[model samples]
Target: MMRQFTNQQDLVHAGISYYTTCCLNLKSLYDNRIELKTMFISKEWEDNMWSKNEAGRRFYNLVVSNEFWDGVLYAINSFEPVVDVLRRMGCGRSSMGNIYGELANVKREIAFRFENKEEHYLPVWYHIDCIKDEHMKTPLHLAGYYLNPLFYYQNGNEIEKTEIFRDALLECAHKMYPDQSVQERIVHQLKLYRTASQSFGRARATLMNFDPVSWWELHGSTAKELSTMALRILRLTCGSLAYEQSWIEMVHKKKPSLVQCNKFEESTFVMVNRRIQEKAQMKDRSCTCIPSQ
Candidate 1:
């Protein structure tokens, strides 16, 4: 029998976060599919279902079978890691520094999950690997990871141990600087940053929000060159979620029927600017209202 599911329209319109959450919840259900299948195949359920219609009984039988349940579980497991990365990337404030490492972890996890069943998972692994090689495997990502204090400090030893990572980071610097002398200066600044970062006890604190851009702004004066590099890297958004959000808002503000054909672009620009101003004002007001300890 078909069951009515509520809020499907809302879920579809809600954006990436909501959709990912729904997928995560569905994954949990798929994890328990075996038990659910047993319940569906029970004598009472079989009697109730069969009493309804021939088609319903046949469908129920197919769903409760081992082959169908296995396929469902496999699909869920295969897509879970991808959904996780997408969820993070689709956030407003996702860290660019974390994307490279996160994708690598996803690749490793997928491999581990399908180690013995290579024939079944090889396609999935190959696709994910191709994405990693094409987009994620870049000097910019390596440099971002190296300069981000959170990853650099936490995964320093691991990063340093990896020859490819070291080479990529240096390669990024060389390309960016171009001049040998400037490259040497950049390297020196990176060393200085490492020293200063190590001595900053506050970096280890968990309560403080770790914003790489803000961190560089506050403490990066000592290593001027590296701070510039850090700021540039940190400013890069991990995904297009913010732009998508703005476009959605603009579309809502200028509904298709009501939008002027000639003035559409102008209207969208005005709407986006207004929204940005509103957000800025709200932030300023909140900051002013906070009482000092």
Candidate 2:
């Protein structure tokens, strides 16, 4: 929703490279990948470097470098409600908390330990050779992918939230893994996620009351203001009455205890952070990764 600059090329390239290192067994190689020591291979190779699909894969470094801190805070604020929804559904806040906590860990992995270190950290594009592709010679990062899927699913428009979520997930794969194989591996896991969701059915409904406009109302000023923000919510409600009623139902059903049905599972990115452990094998280098004219 909010954008800052226009350094897309660096983003795609960095994203692909990051994912390649994470998804593959090339941890050894990543340990040496310094920074903009290498160049992107091809434009077409960008797709698979980020995720199983394209949700947040298109961002560039120019935007990030100029407004990185603002973007991070904004993303965290937006994700707050999504996590709240999940919490109402019985999944604890601790679950989401643990995930963000790791962002500091990743940041520490790269630069020195700042006062408040982060886990969801990334450097610039480097070492094209370490990548095994659908994302060769591309530049992008995983932070966008991570937040995109979270937003798309929690409060996106009329499309299959899964599709949007999948795109973001794939981009994350490219940014966090070592090869396309990691993306491939996640495709199968996605099916499992679908099956588990389906299996829950009404039980799942109890956990999440379908509300399109509630997020709008809380995050937006008024229904009229929200309409100005995104029509997708209007479409999601199929009108406005449906969304309001759904919100009421969800609030009414908010339970403090776990109503577990087969467990809300997430495979791939949550664990197995070994991808980050194996960064690009290069010398400690410094460059904005934003390509100069």
In order, what lDDT does every prediction score? 0.63, 0.30
Give the winner by TM-score: 1
Q: What is the C-alpha RMSD of each candidate to the true structure, in Å?
A: 8.7, 25.0
Global CA lDDT of candidate 1, please?
0.63
Candidate 1: regions farther than 4 A off = 4-58, 105-127, 178-181, 193-208, 240-293
lDDT of 1 by residue, 112-167 (tens): 77765788677888888787777766777877777777767777788778777667
Best by lDDT, which number?
1
- Stretches of candidate 2 off by over 4 Å are 1-165, 192-203, 206-293
Query: Could you tell me every candidate's TM-score relative to the true structure?
Result: 0.59, 0.19
- Native-vs-model 2 lDDT? 0.30
Per-residue lDDT tens digits for candidate 2, residues 191-243, read: 43334343322223332443323333333232232122222313221111211
Residue 288 displacement (Å), model 2: 42
